[model samples]
Target: MGKKSGKQNKLIPESHFRLTHPSVSPASPIVDTHTHLASTFELYRHKYPAGDYTTVFDFVRGLYVPAGVQDIVDVWCEAPVRPLWREFADSAVTEEGRRDLWGGMGYWFVMGVHPHQASEYTDAVEADILEAMAHPRCVGWGEMGLDYHYDNSPRPVQQEVFARQLRCAVRLGKPLTIHTREAEEDTERILKAEVPKDHKIHIHCFTDSPAFAQRLLDWFPNLYIGITGVITYSTNTDTSTTVRNMFAVPASSPPPRLRIVLETDAPYMVPAPIYADPAFVAPDAKGKKLPICHSGMVPWTAGFVADLLPRGEGEGEGAEGWDAARVMTVARENARAVYGV
Candidate 1:
């Protein structure tokens, strides 16, 4: 994505798309199950240096708060965990701190070394993660799993680090936030071996096959699939297919409770709906896309998923089908279920 122009063309709501459709109730606050707040803020600064928001708190309040985003699980997955994480985590400990720092949004986090940085994983790194796990705002361990697509680290090292992280998370009784891509076999094998069936697991930003998702769902009763803006992309058939398979069950069978949670995975996966919205279109008609994604944009992703749902079946009914509010409600419940945030 190109850097945003220095010229301020529109207000925040117009520049960044918000769900104005009546079907999406503003009362149903958004709960972002996964995102990268620090990285997203840095990108925001780069893209719009002279823009309205300066501090991360201001950025979040200006963009996310107005859109009714209530809770967020920011991810801290890297080697040599950033010291700023402590500041962010510590700031969310008290209600006053949360109100002052995150604009009254519930801010929680997960920490671990991502598989791309697996080769850098060491005892010190693991110890730092363990220390964070004890913090009141730290919710889980991961975004750690195998990634055969990039294989930035040696495959064996990735596997070893993944298993190691899994063991630590499981031993500590923490929820698992997994990141698996193009390595379904190893991910499944390792998870089945290392994790308990009833452990709360979140398969973040799932882009894998429906069969793999079904297998994981069948194996782990407490597991929930993470749906991001990627679901709105035409190329990502697997994510939509997985959602369809989960919700489009036989009518004879009771409608399966949605085992899915919504996330932005911000600074990435800006939903397609934003591009289509006239409000976000450049005045010059350049079709410039939003340079960054954030928690507030999750409603568009929810609307996309709601479109894929079977009509007149699940929660809240609308003429078109399941209301986006219902999608938000279900996803919010699933987030609380899996992460307890």
Candidate 2:
């Protein structure tokens, strides 16, 4: 993809993509299948790229929980140069306090190297992610896969890393959370080749052509699309239109409700333009919203999705209105099936 022009860039603010859909009811809960809670502000706050554990915890406590998000499947990277499992174990210890604070329950973490950092992959890193999978809280083997936007790592190298991670997930009986940008063809090819035909996979932060999305869905029954704030904050009507054409109405060409999932790649992709506002003090200590994302954003996302649903079919028979609760429940169940949670 080309670098965004300044004018085009202005149209897409940090939080402009937040889902604004209202909830069907206040009592329902939504599961955010993808997040970067462990990293939070500490991970993104500085150029040095080291996180302050205290700040990370506090952010999760203050913002994420209040959002009404019940559960999260967090994803992040560790120093591949170091012993992988040791770093993961240390992360568990450092984060134990914060994890416990989420209503006194532990949170799930997925360990992997981001495509930008894919060049660091070594035998030890692979071994470590594999070892960490057995930990009760370590649910999957990802934020793996391709990122063509930056190509921070070579294309070949990224492919190698993705294939390796897919093999590990297959061997360990774990699901996958993938990252793809501008590399859709290669990403799909790799998924088809590396992951077993029946493997469960999710393309996180999915922003691609409708045709591509449909092809993947039709070809891989176990694959899913992980939607985030982008679906809501997109000012570009064309993008939304494409989404509607592909997944909104199933009567003409229906997309399976069970193939969709929700996520908040928080601290990075804040849903609303809330981050750009001067008065928009975040719920976290970093002067940002809470780090851990919960289901509070569900209504906003679901509302957008409801708009995409074919209104004619669900009309006056109580089908006209989009039920946020029903959509969220489907999202929750879809995520569980994909992740085997």
Candidate 3:
């Protein structure tokens, strides 16, 4: 969650509020390790805050493809609903479109109920998720963990659900994408207790303390940290009284380059307040904010990384120099680590 200020939310740095300029790229393959193209369409249809999902494919074809993003893992978790969704997304592809637009019309899939969908974790749901995993595209086990702020499900039930998913990942030899929020302590405890040896784990949109991050690193050596524009757009109003959130690792004391990944949780966490601005308009938009954040923004996110990186390390590489190239190198390595791509 971000810091709330009077009616206008204070835009967090990770959110990239003032970023209108594009960073220079070095022709590297950057992967949006996490995103939801389908969800963006849905959010826009409902008229959410940044609900202009039209022209997403055109944007990707023109902007992101030229920008160098190779693949976007379209993750899902609801058992009953997602199987149909997967088919729906798949059916839209023409043979040529599949190869050209989607690079094979294939997406890395993650299966496990999110905390919000925890209510669906019944016997039938479990069966459906298991069946989905059998598909060749299923790559990981979740975007699931604990969310204390929105106690959508009881903590115990969330834990049980998480444990079962972890077990499923272990059996399948697939990595896991985790979503941890205020429930960091319990989330960590359950992970420590349930995650098996050789299990691959990625804590997506991590917002815990650095100490907790360190502990997780120690406990799960294979664990990785996902960085997003959220760092720039963090709504944490406490930035005035306290330092930024704990999950952020200064680029100075960098984690292993392989332990980091880049993500754009589009249609949902549009990086900064700039999306709320009028001048930065979305194409084909009807007075609505851009819902599917163009993957081109990853370079802007890298600018924040360059800003945080220690001085004397040629900081020029971020905003002006090799910033895009540098972030892409680490991001691709992270993908390789997580999926052995």
lDDT against the true structure, each candidate:
0.86, 0.64, 0.62
lDDT of 1 by residue, 33-148 (tens): 99999999998887667777889898877778777888999999999888999999898899998888788988999999899999999999999999999999999998899899
Provide backbone clash counts, one per model: 0, 22, 20
lDDT ranking from best to worst? Answer: 1, 2, 3
Error of 2 at 203 (Å): 0.8
Selected candidate, larger lDDT, 1 vs 3: 1
Worst 10 residues of 1 by lDDT: 1-10
Residue 89 in candidate 1, Cα distance off native in Å: 0.9
- If scored against the real structure, what TM-score would every candidate get? 0.91, 0.74, 0.74
TM-score of 1: 0.91
The deviation in Å at residue 124 for candidate 2 is 1.3
Q: Which residue runs of candidate 2 sit more than 4 Å off their true CA positions? A: 1-27, 43-55, 78-100, 104-106, 235-242, 246-258, 273-298, 312-320
Q: Which candidate is the best by TM-score?
A: 1
lDDT of 3 by residue, 248-272 (tens): 4466753323356777776555555
lDDT at 1, model 3? 28
Alpha-carbon RMSD, candidate 3: 7.5
